[model samples]
Target: MKKITRKKHLEMRLQSIPSHPKPKVGLEQYTTPSVIASDLVWNAFSLGDIEDNVIVDLGCGTGVFAIASALMGANSSVGVDIDEDSIALALSVKDKLNVDNVDFVVSDICDFNQPLDADTVFQNPPFGSQRRAESGQDLKFVKKAISLDPKVLYSFHMASTEEFLIKFYSDNNLEITHIFRYNFPIPKIYDFHSKEKADVDVIVIRAELK
Candidate 1:
């Protein structure tokens, strides 16, 4: 297989990973745009954290980061999600793309305590804004990643919570590294959505263990 050395090619490949067929409002199931996922994964690859590493994507909706890491030559990529429906979709795409290194597990992020030699973790967990999900759900993912003892973590959160997240991560022995900001588009998937699409300021923080 040819290596994906360019960002555009990797983004094009990630576009094949489909979104949730029936998004649940409670899960905050907005798909991370291929553009954003590609950029983040590419940066991780460039930083020497992805290629040939054991990659884990927590709360992976459709396995965007997992599949991207596989394409970028990760040793293995594991995508975990509580929703079986989403995992099913991820499996189908993995098979469709013949990506052998990428795998999916259907389990709640908090209940995921496998002894994975996780080298790096990429998570875009729920922002915890939905009443159905407990607030600070993203923090749970951070703790889980820390427990996995990965060398690095990349997580996304609302830009509004940047200060809180930085302090929380520092308190937990995670050293602040890079902050990548973007205007994430939220499509009108739920009835409560008032616009066709709205942009929310989001930040993807890259942190390493202290």
Candidate 2:
């Protein structure tokens, strides 16, 4: 497979990935936009994290991060999500694209016990802004990623929670490194949403577990 060297091309490729067909309100499942996903994956690739590495995407909705990582030269990309329907769609897309290196699993993040050592992990978990989001759900994802023992972790969070999350990561033994900010677009998928689409400030924290 040819490696996608440029971020622009990677973004273009990722833009074609389909979002969740039936987004669950309780899960707070929103598709990670292609622009942000590509930017983060490109940075990981540039940092010597992607090529020939086993990548994992936690809370993967429709496999954006996993598929993009595979395209960027990951040896294997595993996407884990609790939604079986989303996993089915992701598998269909993966088969359609002939991307043999990516795989999807249906499991709760806490219940996932796969023993494979992951080289890098990407997670765009819930921001805990909605009524259905349990408190510290994002922290749960952080802990699960650490359990995988990845060389590096790229996690998304509400930018407003930066200070608290920094302390949380430190408490969990993750050495702070780079922080990437983006305007995450949230489409009006639910009835509560008033706007057609809105951009929320989000941050992707890059860290290495000690």
Candidate 3:
């Protein structure tokens, strides 16, 4: 298979991937837009982090980042999600697209003990916006990614939590190398969402182990 070396081609390929069957509101299961996913993956590749690298996507809802990385030439990719339905859909999309370099696993981010040996981790974890009890769930994903000790990590977080995340990463011995801001689109999937689509300020932080 010819690798998708261009961002536009990668985005086109990502558009064909399937999304979550039933998006869980509590899990903040919003599909990352293809454009955004493409930009992030391309950025990682440009930084020499994706091509021929072992990549992992934590909380990989429908496996957008993982598949995109594989399409861009990751040696191997693993997408781990707690939702079985999401993993199943991701696997189906992988088969449909014949994306042989990526694999999906159903597992909680907290309990995941797989030997990742990953060079990079690209994840869009829950922003922890739904319930008060789940407010800091994003941190759990960050902590787990840090524990894996990948060479680099690209993670999404609410822009409002920028300060907190900066501190959290620093404290965990991860150095923030780049931050990309985006207006993430959230479609009306829950009863409480009044608007058809709302833009939430989000930031993708690229960090390296310190």
After best superposition, candidate 2 residue 129: deviation in angstroms? Answer: 3.5
List residue ranges in candidate 3 displaced over 4 A: 131-133
TM-score attained by model 3: 0.96
lDDT of 1 by residue, 1-210 (tens): 688989999999988888789998878898999999999999999999998899999999989999999999999999999999999999999998889999999999888987789999999999854445678878888998899999999999989999999899999999989999988998888888778988888999999998
lDDT of 2: 0.90
Displacement of the residue 68 alpha carbon in candidate 3, Å: 0.5
Relative to the unseen true structure, what is the C-alpha lDDT of residue 58 in candidate 3, on a scale of 0 to 100? Answer: 96
TM-score per candidate: 0.97, 0.96, 0.96
Question: What digit string (tens of lDDT, one per residue) describes model 2 on residues 54-168?
Answer: 9999999899999998898889999999999989989988887789999999999899999878999999998875655687888899999999999999999989899999999
Stretch of 10 with least lDDT, candidate 1: 128-137
The local distance difference test score of each candidate is: 0.91, 0.90, 0.89
lDDT of 3 by residue, 1-210 (tens): 786767899899999986677987768889999999999899999999988999999999999999998898899999999999999999999999998999999999888889969899988888865544368777888888988889999999999999988999998999999999998988888888788998889999999998
Residue pairs clashing in model 3 are none
By lDDT, the better pick of 1 and 2 is: 1
